[model samples]
Target: MAFSADELRVLRRALATALNPAPLQGEDVQDCLRLAEAVDDAVREAGRLRAFLLADLARYREALPGSLPGYLELLQDALAAGYDPAVDDLAALRALRANPRAAVLLDRCQVLAERSVRARLARVTQTAVATTPRPRVRLLALPGGRAADEPKPTPAPPPAERPVPKPSEVFPPRRRPVPPPPPEERAAG
Candidate 1:
């Protein structure tokens, strides 16, 4: 598909960014690899989509009208031409010649990109879940640890009889009684 000079420049920039190498630390090797894989997949998918959009835009452009059909058409053309719709923030490009068709195309492209990203993320998430290790907990049962199941120790029986007190000790000796105090002191003093 033929693209305008501006469209070609945008596509070149996008490809450069996509291919650029990102610096990685030792600890980040695995993460970096995952990211690189994901990015590679995304780039491939985006390239395919870009080609398709470009073809559609070419067909639409061949039937271009004198005035703007809508903003959606312009946005579709820009995306089809490989201009990263995500990077284009200024509405001016979308509103070129005040076409509403461009805006609609931008919305559609945004939805498509979001769906693609979600699908990729789901795949990685499922893979991570499958590869993750489960934690193990061990339970040990020791012999004689439980009171109910363990044999009880036999207790010695008490002595046959307690010692009995002797009769002499029970009925001790008796002493002579002392005389009473003086009779007058004894009488209710």
Candidate 2:
């Protein structure tokens, strides 16, 4: 959610009040409530914007592979809305590389995709260390309260570790070529 500087300041003050409970004046209470409502409104607006952008991206992604009218324009709009190109997008762009417009779109998608990945990496690096490992707590019942027929707790099996594929294996340079049409079918067509 996007917040103005004033809103953020108000939010910080509200949080401080919450963390340290004190008798607040009626004016302060009303201000805090108003700020909370404003924050909620901002959050809802952001959510709506996000949903619209995602739907737009999906529409372009689906249309790009077809010979639909305005698909190219749709692609440009999607890129502007922060669409992350997938492998399919790359392949489609490659196929359409002969078209100058497609080439421009391809270059834009490549740059956007690289920037997107870098931004994600930056966020991950910044917040990764902030996550503290949660302490595992075991609950025990009252002493001498064991049931005679109660089954013993079984240990969980360790998770199997799958080997990570190399980037080359994961993302091949090209898809397998389409097989040639059969001679009989080709002649009929």
Candidate 3:
């Protein structure tokens, strides 16, 4: 989010005081509080605006081909705000494919739908993995328990311990190998 100059100034002063451990003036504290409230208000307004936009989109979707303009506008705005298109939106776009814009939107929405599904699947996989019991990792030595099942990460050997990779292996080959200079040229050389 872009911060205004005033907000940025307040933020800078607050951070400076935080790091330097200097006592803040009453006015500085007030400014920081005001900035926090402004940030909270902006967040709330964003949520409300998104909710309203979603409601309007649903209404327009129900109105079908008749409210195409408003539907498309709201859908585009929602998409810009990271709203995942619903199945209904996909269906509506497909049905309205006679409109060139709707056809294009259908393609875009299809891509978004696939991405959303993949994200959801990834989340579910992560959640499943997280929920399955893992050996508790302890930072400090546990009093009497067995060590964690996960092996401790081994530290990398010092630079001198192993030979460094050649530059070609470290970096990708920048150019394709010259074609063997042809068999006749090789023999001549």
Most accurate candidate by TM-score: 3
Whole-model Cα lDDT of every candidate shown, in order: 0.60, 0.77, 0.92
61-142 in candidate 1: lDDT tens per residue?
4454433454345555565554554433234434453556545555666676677678889999999999999888687665
Lowest summed lDDT across 10 adjacent residues in model 3 is found at 142-151
Per-residue alpha-carbon lDDT of model 3 for 54-96, expressed as tens digits? Answer: 9989999999888999899899999999999999999999999
Please, what's the RMSD in Å of model 3?
A: 20.2
Cα error, candidate 1, residue 71 (Å):
12
Give the per-residue lDDT of model 2 (tens digit) for 33-132.
8888887888798778868866665676576656533667766766676568767777778778888888888898888778888999998987886786
Order of quality (TM-score): 3, 2, 1
Residue 19, candidate 3: Cα error in Å is 3.7
CA RMSD for every model? 24.7, 20.2, 20.2
Q: TM-score for every candidate vs. truth?
A: 0.28, 0.43, 0.67
After aligning candidate 1 to the native by TM-score, how far in Å is the CA of 16 from where it should be?
47
Candidate 2 clashes: the total is: 0
Error of 3 at 2 (Å): 4.7
Ranking by lDDT, best first?
3, 2, 1
